[model samples]
Every structure is written in C-alpha cells, then in structure tokens.
Target: METRRVIFFLFDQVHLMDLAGAVTVFYESGCCGQPYELRYVSPYPQAGVSCGLSFTNLEPLEAVTITSSDILMLAGMDLSKWNHADDMKWIPWVQAAAATGATVCSVCTAAFALAVAGLLDGRPCTTHWGYTAALQEHFPKAQVLENRLFVQSDNIFTSAGISTGIDLALYLVEQDHGPAFAYKVAKDMVIYIRRDGAATQQSVHLQHRQHINHQVHQVQDYIAHHLPEKITIDDLAALVFSSSRNLTRLFKTVTGITIGQYIKELRQEKALQLLKEGHKLSWVAQSSGISSQGELRLLAKQAGRGRLA
Candidate 1:
C-alpha cells in the first residue's frame, strides 16, 4: 500500500463544511490505520472562507506535486463571487493532474469548476440541485445528471452539495479501503444516516444504521467486517455486553428491523456490489456470507435482480 496523497486544492471563499467533511473522512481513515497523506494547497497565500474566516500559512499549489496516486479535491464556492481569471489559472494544473492519472473530485458547484477545467467534459457529473441545469448549459460537453448525491466517472468524482461531500468522501474511503472500514468511519463521525430523497450507491452498510444507539453502530460494524462468518444474535449481544434478548429488542427498536433481516439486506448488497464488479459466483457467495452459489442465485432471484444470471 503506497501512501496516497489526498490534496484539497483550496481557493478564496471556499465553503468550510464542504472542505471539512471530506477532510475529516481521510483524517479519520488515517487514524483507523489507512495511511493517507492529507495536504492542503492553494494558489492564494491566505485562503479566505465562509463568514469572514481565513486560513493562513498554507502551502502554494506550485509546491505540491500531483501524482497518479493523489486524490485531488475542489470544494465549492459561489461562482459569481469567484475570480474567473484566477479560477481559469487552475485549469492547466488540474488538467495536468488528470493527465497524470490522479483522481480528481469536486463538491457542490465545484463541479462547475471541474467543468471549467474541462475535466468533466463528456463525463457524467452533478452539482447542487440549483446548478445542475446551469452545469449542463455551461458545460454542454459534460453530461450533467440531476438528483444524484454524487457521480463518479472513472477516476473523476463530483458531489451534489455541501454535506454530500461527506457522502462522497465516505464513498471514496470505501473504494480505498472496504465497506467495513467506511462503515466504521461513518459511525465514528456519527453520520450513519444516508441523505433522504437522494439516490446514491451509498454503502449498503449505511442502511439499517439510521439509529444513533452506540451499541447498534458497533454491532453493525462487526456485522460488516464479519459478514462472511456465521453471525449470531448471541455473538453480537456478547460483543456489546448485553443479553441476547435485550440486545435483539434494542437492535430492532433502534434499526426498525430484526438482526436477521438486517444481515440479509447487507449480504444482498455485498453480493450485488460483487456481481457488479464481475466476481465469480462462488467467490461472491463466500465473501457475502451466502451458503453457496445456489443461495446467491436464490437471494438475487428474491430481489428480482435477474437471478444472478
């Protein structure tokens, strides 16, 4: 595992939370033992932010080198207030970053920025609800998708709005690590609930985890990592230091479903993701906790997803 750099390329008037959310994701992942060298660079010496806040003593974009393993991020700001000439200066740098195989990402109206950089050209990207139309109109070459929380096009990623940056970050963490580790990051950040009314391939583990119960989140984390194992209510209860009946009751009360049902949904989602990635049926079954390919086919059939064909 190489030490990948997660670079936040900042500018004046950058939204704080949009930057903070994604920053926290990688930072927490590092704390969780996935080493990501987080770096912040800006063309501006002093980066002005929302509500008169500012960051000083920051490294310049010229100082940091973008490599293929780097994750380059652009947090959004009001396009109208943006210095178009200064913004255009970033185009060449981002183009170079992409040409070198870096993973470029934009949050909120930053998709417009990426579009301005020509990174979103011919790529399916999204932004805040209000800007999707403008994104399409302005970057006709870029395919703008509406109502998506975030859209990933090959190595490029774009997120819908402010907090969706967090979702997008979680998604990236899952891509870098695994769903189990992303689940832990989300739970630790207390963002277990998926955004309502938006369609995302948000981790299946994020579902059935809408509750804030500490023990429930721990159990869900355990279930995520141990999905391929034989999970029992008694085992989960013991892990949380509670009686099986009490833990089961509390789990259902918090998550609105029994543990068995929750496990089934998680296994289904894992199987589905594995299938999408073109894993063989036997491997999918073993990794997703299914008894066999026969059970995997049955699970896919019950979900009306073409019987794993």
Candidate 2:
C-alpha cells in the first residue's frame, strides 16, 4: 500500500484542539500504524507552535519544494489580524499545492486562510460559527454555511470550530477504511459516528420563521420561546390557528426538516456552543432545555461529524 502524506500547516495562535484532535483521531485509528504519514509544517522552520498551552512539533513550510502530498491541512488561526500581505505571500504557493491533485482541508477558522488563498471560491464550505458571517462577507463567491459541522466539495473540506476536526478526521477514516472500521474507531473513542448540519444556531429561530407563513412563523417562534415547556406539534399548530398536518408540511418545506428535527437540532447546537464556551456539560444541557445527557452526547456527535472524502 502506498502511504499517504498528511501535512498539517500550523502557525502562532493556532487552536491547539483543532490540530491535536485530528492528529489523535488519525493516529488512534491505526492509519499511522500503516500507510499513512503525518507531519507538521509551519511558515517558519523551527519556530515552535504555541497552541494555547504548550509547544507542538513544527517543520518549516519553505523547506519543502515539492507540491505533491496526499493531503494538506490548514489548522485554525486567528484571522482577524490577517493582512493582505500575508495573502499575497502565500497564494501562489497554495495554488501550486492544489494543482498537485491533493485533497486540501481547513479546520475551524482556518477556512479563512483557504478563502484568502482563493481556494474556497464557489465551493460549499464552512468555518467556525463565530466567523461564518465574516467569511461570507470576505468571500462572497463562496457558499458559506453557518450551521454545518463540515462541508466537503470536490477535494476540499472545511470544518467547524475546534473538536469538529476530530469528526472530519473520523469521516476520512470512514472513507478510507469503511463504515465498520470507522464505527469501531468511534466506539473506541466513545464518540458518535453520525452528525448533520440540520443542527441549529442562534439565528435559526428567526431564520426559520422568516421563510414560512405568518402562522407557521408564530408557531416556530412560540416553540423557540417555550423550548423548556412541553410544547407539542398539535399545541404549536393550535397556537398558529392550523392543523398539525399542515404545520408539519410547512415546517419541513421551509427548513427542509420536520419540526421535531428542527427543534432537536436547535437545542443541540445551542448546547454545543454553550459547552464550547466552557459552560459545564451538565449546565449546558440544563440551560439549553435539553432534558437528557445522552441526547446531548448524540447532538454533540451530530454536530461533530461532517462530510467524508
């Protein structure tokens, strides 16, 4: 078997979780035990990567002249301070690397780097939810999705914040090894194998309401306002002056998901964002109105896994 070279591009202020999660997932899957080579490369050779807490092994990017690699991964970086000079400096190199037919990926806010390099233009991609609006504003040609855990179009993959990188890695593990192997790896890791973008975010309540009829909107709004309450579809429909059947169809059409699915997704997403913000897992579930811890785990799993390539 030919070994696949996976290069992780790192920089200062890179999110340590994003890089380490991916490395851990791939390493634990036994891919590194066989035909898989993983290495860390940086813009400056020998400069240690200060990811949150500790230094990470990093090689210089300029040290290698070859553009060919099985995969190139751009780890999370704080792009708020990124400059045009930085873009001009690496565009040619990035473009050349992509021309080699290697799969390219970005984790969390690292999608900003890919977009600045013009690699995400017209591609279906995602980034950390906090940056989704800015990413769309910066790269209008790119279709930016805020609620997705990851988006895979062509050979380029972009995932949401932090731990979502592990999901993306596990997704790749599934593609290369098969579902059974992927399941085993996920099981061993005590992680979920299936995740989806049907998950929610802050603007989801208003977003869904705006797309549907006024009655449907009222019901959705009511649901959002009363999430902790035991509100049913029938109850929601009555509040909207409609039958449950009509409400269900409208909900599905407007959001491309059933009412229950939408509610669950919204609750899950909020729970996750809260958890990432350092809210205790127990508190996140309680505050988000999700009753079950197992349910939260399933949602986290759903929010983590993304497209497989």
Candidate 3:
C-alpha cells in the first residue's frame, strides 16, 4: 500500500465535527492496511475551535510542502470574515496547491474558501444546504449544487454540512483503496456507508438497505458485487436457504421491490458509475450486466434518464 499524506487545514472557530469526523476516517484506515500520514497545519499556530476547546500543536501553513498525492481538507468555518486580512497569504497557496495536482476538498462552508481560490469555478460543488444560494450569488462561476450530500468534479470535492464530511472521507478512502476496504472502515466506525449524492442519487450499496431483513441484505450485497454475472431467483433462494416461492415473496415484501427489479437497478447503478468515470460504452455494458450498449441505453431511458452517458 502506498503512503498518502492527508492534511487538514485548520482555522479558528472551525466546526469540530467537520474536522474530527474526516480525521477519524483517515486515521482508522491505517488499521486496514492503508498507510496514511495524517497532518494538521493551520494559518495560525493555534486557535479556539467550535467545540469550546483550543486546537493546539499545529504547524504553520507555510511549513509543509504540497504534492499531487497529498490531500488537503478544509472543514467548515465562519465565512463572514473569510476575506478579512487573510488574502495575501492562503488563497494563493491554495491556488498553487491545486495547480500542483493536489486533491482540494472542502466540507460545508469551506466551499467559500475554495471559491475564493477560484477552484470551484465551472466545477459542480456543494456546501451546506442553507448556503448554496449565497455561494452561487457570491461566486457566479461555480456550479453550486444544492441537494448533494457531496459532489466530486475531478479532484475537487465538496460536501454538505458537518456529518457528510465523514461520507466524503469514506468516499476518498474508497477511491484510494476499494469498496470492500471502505465498507470495512465504515463498519468499524459503526456508521452506514451513505455513498455520494443525495436522495435519488444514492449509491446502490446504501439505496436498498432501508429494510431490516438480513436475508434481503445478503441477496442485495451478492447482486451488487456480481453485477457482471447472471443471477437467478433460484440462486438467491438457495443462498438464503429458502424455497424459491417463499424467497421471492419475502424479498418483495421486505424491500418493496422484486428480486429482478433489485438486480436490474443495481446493474444500472454500476453502469451509471462507469459512465460517470468516463468508461467506454461497451465496457460499461459488460461490467454492469446490461448485455449491450442498446440495452443499457434502453434501461437508462426507461428510468427517465435519457442520454445517461
């Protein structure tokens, strides 16, 4: 495993959860075969944080060097005074860091800082739900997304509110490692892996888990990981140790969707993820169990997402 430095950009009166939640995710990944050097650097040497405690033992912002493999995380902060006397220093540093290919990320109100550095311009980014309009009004160039749990446009990532920072951090871990490892991290943290996007855009890993059926959960997990293979109702029934008739009826009752529909949606979700990552259409079809390009397009179109690719 490669060692990656995950640096947190600290400031005075910063939201503690915004910083700590993501820090916990990266720090805990070390136990799971992912080596990460977690560092904290601040514009000031030390300052008071939102949790009524001071953030101490911090290095100055100019002390460390930035690299392409480094991850810079800016947590939520008081944005009203963002432009006050700090212009000549950190903004240019942030711009240069992004130019150097470091992945720039923000949680909640820190989107304003990224916007000030002009990183979010023409990129789809999100902030706390209440501040989306203000961000768009102030920085008209940024494509501000309102209802996203988080948005990832290339290397720049932004999330909504404090808790979603953990979601984004888990996502970052997933990108570096893999879904299975990320899921392990989430399981260890005792939190759900609420994958990227809000509402209807939720990842397949989380979307169908609203029910309390263990058998259905197992079936869904199997279907998701085996998207490229053919799965029959008999396979699921045997896996759950039930008759085909009983399993089919119970699956629909528990998940509110039939087994076939669940499999199809899982494949569609895989196809959409592949498409978003710029894979070729044929590969998307094959990897997502869509049979062919024509079938993939037809499924997406029927789902009310025309020209999905």
Candidate 4:
C-alpha cells in the first residue's frame, strides 16, 4: 500500500490545535491500513506559535515537494498582523502544489493564505466566522459561506474556526477510506463524526447528548445501533429495567424529545444515509425501520418542512 503524505504548513503565531487536530486524525487514520507520512514545513527553519510555544525540526517550505497523492494543510494564525510581503514567497509553492493535483486545505484564517495564492478564486470557501466578511472583502472572487463547518470546492477545502479543523480532517478521512472507518476513529477520539459541510452549527447526535443520565444514554445507544429493529418504549424500558412511562419522561427531560420522536428522527437520518449511498427506497425504508417508502417520504417531507421539531 502506498502511503499518502500530509504536509502541514506552519507559520509564526499559528494556532497549535488547528495544526495538531488534523495531524492527529491522519496519524490515527493509519489504523485503516493506509499509512500516512506526516511532515511539517515552514517558511522559516523554526516557527514560533501562539501561547508562547515554538516548533523545531521544521523543513523549509521551499525545500518540500508536493504531488497529486499528497495533501497540503495550512494552519490558521493571527491574520490581522500577517506580513503579506514576507509570506508572499510561499504563494507560488501553494499554487504549484495545487497545480499538481494535491489536495490543498486551510483551517480558519489560513484561508487568507490560500486566497493570496489565488487558489480560492471562484471557489466556495469559508473561514472563521469573525473573518468571513474580511475574507470576502479581500478575495472578491471567492464565495465565502457563513456558519459552515467547512467548505469543499473540488480538491480545495476550507474550514471554519479553530476546532472545526478536526471535523474537516475527519471528513478527509471519510473521503479517503469510508464513513465506517471515520466513525471508528471518531469513536476512539470520543467525538461525534459530524456531518458534511452543509450541516448546521451542531449535529443532531451531538446536540441532544449533553446529559448525565446513564439510563437515557443506554437507551440512546441501543436505538442508534438498532435502527432497523422495531423498538418500542417497552423494549427500551426493559433495557434499563424501568417502566415505560418513567423512561418516556426521563428521555424527554434529558434529550428534549420523546422516545418515539427520537426513534423517528434516527430512522429518518438512517434512511437519508442509505439513500445517499445509492440504496433503493424500499431497502432504505426497511433498513431504517420505517414501515414503507410512503412513510419515509412523509418523514422526509416533515424534515424538509422543519416540522420534525
């Protein structure tokens, strides 16, 4: 198996987590049987980062070579104080990498660097919410989306603020391997495998899970794994040795949704996933525990109408 190279472009005052988060995803992605070679390149021999930290053993950006099979990531930094003249030298390198078909991406304000390289022109991109207007003002050709976790325009990807870098990295992993493999990595990391860039600020799975009820969580886990099973309040109550009525009350109190509603939402989500993967409507309906295609359509309509809430 050929190893893919992930080159991280480091610069002065770079956000450490933005750099480390994506690196960690690729590092752990080796479990999928494809190893990745991680390299950190910078315009300088050494680069000082935020929070009084510095990185050594960095390769010079001019010395690195990127290929089509490789990925180039630019870490976010203090864009307001960025010295455009000093960093303009790296623009050609970024353009060269992109021209070679390398997947180029940026986290947060790093989109500014990519824009300066002329790679974001006419592309759907996003940066930190606070900098979205500024990015649009500077790069008039780029379509800057607001509130998106990340945006992918062909091989060029740009992510929202700091922590969304991890989300973007996991997404890249999903693109490389598959959703199942990405889910495994996310489980190991104890983070939700967020949906694609079109999703809102938070995922449905992450939003309703911020509670401390063990029994409720157990029920949720069971529902998630058994989406195709005909689950009832009695069955769920039996799992946690509680009464149906009490479980219903606790589930609503904890998750802000009734058990039936949660099950319906889960089934609809699963149906959408199956459909996205090219499954037949009947098969998706069966697999997602919906009674029939008509019912799935009803659920889809409700979702589209925002009536599921």
Q: Pick the candidate with the highest TM-score.
A: 1
Total clashing residue pairs per candidate? 0, 1, 0, 0
TM-score for every candidate vs. truth?
Answer: 0.84, 0.59, 0.78, 0.79
Report the CA-based lDDT of candidate 3 relative to the real structure: 0.83
Error of 3 at 172 (Å): 1.4
Residue pairs whose backbone atoms clash in candidate 2: 195-302
- Candidate 4: list runs displaced more than 4 Å: 28-35, 180-184, 187-197, 200-225, 233-254, 272-281, 292-294, 297-309
Give the lDDT of residue 117 in candidate 3. 83
Compared with the true structure, all predictions reach lDDT values of 0.84, 0.71, 0.83, 0.82
Compose the digit string of candidate 2's lDDT tens values, residues 1-309.
Answer: 776677887755667788888887777777434346777776644333344454545666665453454678888876644444645555676677787877788999889888888889999899999989999998999999878888888888899978888878877776787644654566556655445445332145434432425565566656666666676888888887789898898878866778987787667667777765656667776678898967777666655633211
| lDDT at residue 206 of model 3 (Cα atoms) | 71
Better model by lDDT: candidate 1 vs candidate 2:
1
Q: How far in Å is the alpha carbon of 137 misplaced in model 4?
A: 1.3
RMSD of each: 3.4, 16.6, 4.6, 4.8
- Deviation in angstroms for 259 in model 2? 25
Q: Give per-residue CA lDDT, model 1, range 222-247, as digits (tens).
A: 89889899999999999999999999
Q: 1-65, model 3: which lDDT tens digit per residue?
A: 56899989976778889999999999889987787999898887776677688888898878888
Better candidate by TM-score, 1 or 3: 1
Estimate candidate 4's RMSD in Å: 4.8
lDDT of model number 4: 0.82
Clash pairs, candidate 1, are none
Clashing pairs in 3: none
